[model samples]
Target: MTKTAKLYRMVMDKHVCPYGIKSKWLLEREGYEVEDHHLTTREQTDAFKGEHGVETTPQTFIDGRRIGGYTALRAHFGRREADEGGTSYTPVIAVFAVGAALAIALSLFAFGAPFTVRTAEWFVAFSMAMLAMLKLQDVEQFSTMFVGYDQLGRRWVPYAYAYPFLEATAAVLMAGRLLPWLSIPIALVIGTIGAVSVFYAVYIQKREIKCACVGGSGNVPLGFVSLTENLAMIGMGIWMLLRPTL
Candidate 1:
């Protein structure tokens, strides 16, 4: 006899709970026959919740025993709990990945070649612009968090607010191949400052803090990813400075 699982979920016309769909999929994947009970109306949903003595929907029961919500079901399967603190590198990864793809596409369209010295330049410029945009979204929040580690931001608070605009300007100027004298120095100075700040904060001080790379709200830990971002900018700045000479 196959052990049947019962799932109580809210499936109204205007509101279809996402957890309920996930719960159903999970139960099916686990080889359990699910008896789905949909609370279609508000009255039914309220009545069901009152009867079950539960506050939320998507409740699961296995073999006549209650298994609670999606979190509880995941626990029963020994899965790791999801962090609510937004402490994931997913946003950073997504931004960088998309920027790289866009850079490559732009390079291919402009130079008619996928791999070129110009392509690397484009990649760096795009990355800088994208990162700057993220910071600029909420400059106040970003500056507040940035001052925690950045030496310059700590001393001169306005620098933190100005940093994103500087980065964006440099990126735009470099991408346009305009005013090397201004753009190159801007990139070089900011990149140098960023790299030093990241190194001092992560390596020298050994501080475990959130990175303001993506935004103030993001919880990306200050470490290798942050260091890499600064290094990339520094390398790009140096490359641009030496390109004309080489």
Candidate 2:
């Protein structure tokens, strides 16, 4: 039988307010039943924290265990969530990897094969390299964006340093089909970023940014096609997260 656990998020401050809401959303997404207990009064909140040995709001108690806050919860749940999701979408991810390979091949073949693909290409390549690195250590590259590559401060934009080398390693591994396990996660991460970039341009950004996805000089708008591509890639990532290892 599945375990039923109670989680309590103490919302004391407003700055940390979004933490609770985001926590609730994540739990719901993972099919968990969250019961909220709002303690606005200092006396009540202090007493509650003391009882649980918690020193802050947005404190989470999982099955009676005092799991600190957002980072704490992430530490406990992130891998499990990734594992659960990854295990369910093995087939879907395989299909996505195949499709990605075909797209790259076709695009290369169609455009008369440029001497090299740069920028986004390198970023994607690095992502795959990270995947291989993670699989070697039995970790999940859940999202394509790596904290290691975060150099744009609050923007979290990827840096252009050493990305090509990183991705090239993965591409080499992939070319030889040396490790299917590693390649799958790599593809999922790149596909997701591509999809999200396309989506943000369409829905959030609301600007027709050209899809430099494959390193072509083509400037395309944020059209329905881009949205569809984004959704498809995100779907692939979701599936990879859910699918099990074969």
The TM-scores of all predictions, comma-separated, are 0.83, 0.30
Q: Residue 117 in model 1: shift from native, Å? A: 1.1
Off by over 4 Å in 1: 1-3, 85-87, 109-113, 179-181, 244-246
**Lowest-sum lDDT 10-residue window in model 1:** 237-246
Cα displacement (angstroms), candidate 2, residue 111, comes to: 20
How high is the CA lDDT of each candidate model? 0.87, 0.48
Candidate 2 lDDT over 1-246, as tens digits, reads 444445555556653367777767766666677777777667887797788777866776667777777667777786444443221323324434654565466446756653333222432343344333432332222123222222221144332223333344545544344464775565555555545555555677676443322222222333454344434434433443464331
- What is the overall TM-score of model 2 with all chains considered together? 0.30
RMSD each, Å:
2.8, 19.2
Tally clashing residue pairs in candidate 2: 18
TM-score of 1: 0.83
